[model samples]
Target: MLFNSYSFLFAFLPLLLVSWRLAQGYGPTGLALVLLAFSTVFYGLWGLPFLIMLAVILGMNYAFALALAAPEPEQAQPAATTEAGSEGEAEAQAKTESACMCGSRKQGGCRFRLSRKSLLGVALVLNLLPLLWFKYSAFLAQNLAALLHVQWHFTSPGLPLGISFYTFIQIAWLVSVYRGQVTPQGFTRHALFSACFPYVISGPIVRYEQMGQQFDALSPITAENLAKGFTLFTIGMVKKVLLADSIALYADSVFNAAEKAFPLSGGEAWLGSLCYTFQLYFDFSGYTDMAVGLALMLGLKLPENFDSPYKSTGIVDFWRRWHITLSSWLRDFLYIPLGGNRQGRFMQYRNLFLTMLIGGAWHGAGWTFIVWGALHGSMLSINHFFRACIKGKTLERILALAPLRLCSILFTFFCINLCWVVFRALTIEGAGRMYKAMFAGPFTREAAGLSATTDGLAGFAAMVARWLPNNYIQGWIPFALLLVSFFVVWALPNSHEVLHGRRDGSHPRLGWRPTAAWATGLAVMAFLTLILVSRKATFLYFQF
Candidate 1:
């Protein structure tokens, strides 16, 4: 069911589009039903059991939302039909209306609010249960076993695809319903919202409010949307096939070496880390592009996700740019509720730490992820403190200089790169080995077990001899590719900029336009991506 797969591009999408176009004449409801049926088929492709789970969750949430909506009290008084004859009469009428409004508010406050909150809590727990069992059971069991000094043997259940994403989406919906931010759409629209194939897997973590109107107004596909969608999809395809997968070769080799406890030179460590940094960016961002494109083709608009995160000068800025949806979700749902800087300096820091800790755990069931989250949390807290300290100081003026700004950007990128090591590693020990090699002395390959022949320059030379013959060109290629990636990332206009007609001030180049020439170029890019799609790699975020 990967969008990159030929079966999807050639078969599923085409069939669905044709069916949708055919159904458009039948009206929006018919078109929506078509979409819902196709979405169900898509989910069913993963596994019938999981599809059943999704259906039950959707049904349960829909039922809860309906119940929550039902108890909404009606207006207590009807409007008066006769017009006021005098000023005194008008004032008396206004007072009566005000009193009625106040009484209605009191009634809703006493009954509706408490019931809605209880229903939302129930829905949240029910929706999250599957995610908890499938995603975290192993991590919990192992930790509990260690603490109690008992060997706990339990077979972990397989995690259903997109469980984390869909669960979060539903939770957001429940909360919105409780707060009266979203009205309960019927089962059909709610189901479609939850299971839209483009986002059901890896997502921008869409909200019901964002897509509910579009679902009701589902329109026929248009040439403008088609061109824009195709262009976006092509750009994403090139990024994934040409850039991410190509860099992944080098990144995989180095990470695999580290996993095997192979000794790494400092040069190799940095190069590999850099490759992985770009690899992850292109991989996840590329997926987001395809998702957005696919949604656009269907006349639906998904929220933007990535916004050139590497260019960020601070950790907070980086989070705002990278995984924009997830960050916003955590802020609104977790951080704000936890008193998000409103309480005091200490509470703000505590909230930030806890939010990131939960955010990291949401990615996977591993201590590495927890530590990675902690790293960002700690840095963000320090960043906030630094900002506070510099608010009215001469140091603030110094940091605003161009060179300082560039240094800040580089420093932020470097910190992010280091964090990615923990995020990508198989274990904390593996990440530790990589970090040690990354910071080791230039000629100290011996400590990593690369050479045992001598203690001095001879051992270094022997290590060099062993590495040079095999990796000389291999090493250079990744560095060269890394340079190209850096140029593209820092210089070229991103997909959003190009598609939206914004110029890249830093490096103006050819921009995307819907012309015959551009169309041909897009076709060629699509062809090349199709050729590479046989490699059949899934997106990195799919695991989460």
Candidate 2:
């Protein structure tokens, strides 16, 4: 199901493009049908049961909306002389509140507006049902078993592919429908919007209204968009195939064999941990880039997800830079709903903690993830407290001084790396052991795994170990390359600058030099792909 796989990239994408473009010649309806068929095939690849579940939910939502939009019986008024002003006021109030879509409008005032309360009830239940089933079924079952003292064993059927994404898309759609933002684009557009294969598994979470415009627009693909699209697509492929995947191997080797992965000195463990952190960023973000790039090629502009987050000085700054779409989604849908900053101080903190806790839970069904989220939420809370105490004074003064900035940056990286232990660990116990080992002792040669005593485990130690021999030197080379790659990504220009209309963007003007640079980037990417072809790796985010 990964977009990077040979089956998806070479087989599925090509087949879909040909069929879709061919069908588009017929009309919008034909195109919609083609997309729906392909999307179903893509989803059905996960399992037939998932497809059935999806269909049932889609049907339920569609039916519920129709029912909500059905006309309500008029309330009988008492036979009393009403003032002219009162009658006019009632008419204006009705107009203000009633915005609905049911059947076709007639010459007189149409009765289409639904009870908002009823619509809300159906939307929340229908939209959240799948999320609860897929994400928390095991957790819920465990709690229920404990409560009832039942002997029933609960085993989780693995999640439906892209359930997280499709769930979010459906919820957003239903909310928009309830809010009178989306006119019914009919069934086909709704289906396509919910299950667009390119972005369903991992997403920029393309909104309902956004896709509606694209579905209805008569504009043909322009050369300018095509060029930008192809450029983005090529760059994304390079990032995923070459850079991200390459770094991941070293990260895996080290983390997987934590206790025995050489004599992991404090320095070595820190280096390895940081490497994994960066590896995850690139791996997940690279997949997102490819998704956005692919969508763009199809004339859809999926939102950007990351900036140069590593460059951020604070946790708040890091969150803003990383996973831009998800953070924004959580803010808009969850945080704001919980009162946001408009509420008093205690409530604001409550909302912040709850938002992050839920956000963490959204990532996975584990206490470790909850801890990871709590760590971030705590950092944010402390930062907020400091801001209030500091008044308008800048932390910039401290950061402007070289020592303070370096110390804080290094501390921040270490803190984030420590959190990754929880984020990456196989279990809570594994994380606890890793933490204990870090402070347990000084550098030693006792710890051993593959390439354990290779002497090139730590970069500084590895540099010193370079004069040792063949296997040791060879292993160190890959590690060295990984180190260099981290620095490159860490120092890379801000992707957000290019994504937004910021003056200082990562991409230069699209002149001949820039075009040549892109070509070089493509070549580097192809070489990376060749390296990775021998070892297929799943993207890190697929678990989420």
Provide TM-scores for the models.
0.87, 0.80
Per-residue C-alpha lDDT of model 2 across residues 1-544, encoded as one tens digit per residue: 6676778768887887787667767776676677678889988888899888888877777666554444453542433466965686556545533444444445444556546666667677867877888888997787788889997777887787677777777777777776677756567667787888778887877777677877665233455555565556655666667767776665665556563433334444555566678778777777877777666666777766877677666677778878887888888888898999897877877888899998888888877899989988888777677656656567646555888866766776677778887888766766665565465543344322225545554733554333222221235655676666666665545443443344443353432233677667666765667556556677778788
Candidate 2, residue 311: Cα displacement in angstroms equals: 1.8
Query: What is the number of backbone collisions in each predicted candidate, taken in the order shown?
Result: 0, 1
Name the best candidate (by lDDT): 1
Clashing pairs in 2: 260-449
Q: Poorest 10 consecutive residues of model 1 by lDDT? A: 105-114
Candidate 2, position 387, lDDT: 59
Q: In model 1, how large is the Cα lDDT of residue 231?
A: 88
Q: Which candidate leads the pack in TM-score?
A: 1
For candidate 1, write residues 197-225 as lDDT tens digits.
88998898999889999998888999989
